[model samples]
Target: MWNKLFVDHPRTVQESYGEHAVMAASFGGRMVLAGLACLVHAVVPGLFVRTGSRTITVLYDEMVVNRNRKANKAAGEVAAVGGR
Candidate 1:
């Protein structure tokens, strides 16, 4: 149960438990801030017009692009070691 709760997803993501926790918290914090900005922009319609979308795009790139790079690197390293 402990492994299921803490270890499995992080391993799939190539992060340790603590690293995953910290990263998840950071993503949540950023999303909350972006949501607040979106709320304000809905009423003001001029301020922070780009903040929410920009944040989402940046986060998506970070999560998808960077993670794929990491996974590919890891796979390459494993293949090299196995070939050796």
Candidate 2:
């Protein structure tokens, strides 16, 4: 139950429990900051016109690319082991 609660999801993402915690927290922080920027930009159109949108784009790209990278890495490891 503990493993299922904490470790399984992180392992599936190719991260340890602590690593996943830190990374997820980092993403959440960035999202919060971006949301704040967006709220401010809503009121003040001239300021931070691109900051929030750019952050969203960057965060999304990072997630997709990282997922692909982890998948490719795992596949390569599997192939290497099978070849030997």
Candidate 3:
């Protein structure tokens, strides 16, 4: 149960527990800042015109695109080895 709660997901993502924790925390912090910026923009009308969108784009690239790339690469390697 502990491994399932703490280790499995991190291992699947090729990260240690500590590494995953730090990465998740960093992303969470960035999201909070982006949300604040968007809130400010909503009231001010001009500031942070691109901040929210830019943050989403960056986070998507980091979290989705890169993760898919890594998973695909690992899968390909396993397939190659199995084929040999």
User: Tens digits of per-residue lDDT for model 1 on 30-58?
Assistant: 99999999999999999998999999999
Candidate order (lDDT): 1, 3, 2
Query: Sorted on TM-score, highest at the top, how do the candidates line up?
Result: 1, 2, 3
Clashing pairs in 1: none
- The worst-scoring run of ten residues by lDDT in candidate 1 lies at 61-70
lDDT of 3: 0.94
How far residue 75's Cα lies from its native spot in candidate 3, in Å, is 2.4
Q: Point out where model 1 deviates above 4 Å.
A: none
lDDT of each residue in 1-84, candidate 2, tens digit only: 999999899998999999899989999999999899989999999988998889989999998998999999999999999999
Regarding lDDT, does 2 or 3 come out ahead? 3
Q: 1-84 in candidate 3: lDDT tens per residue?
A: 999999999998888999899989999999999999999999997999999999999998899976888799999999999999
Q: By TM-score, is 1 or 3 better?
A: 1
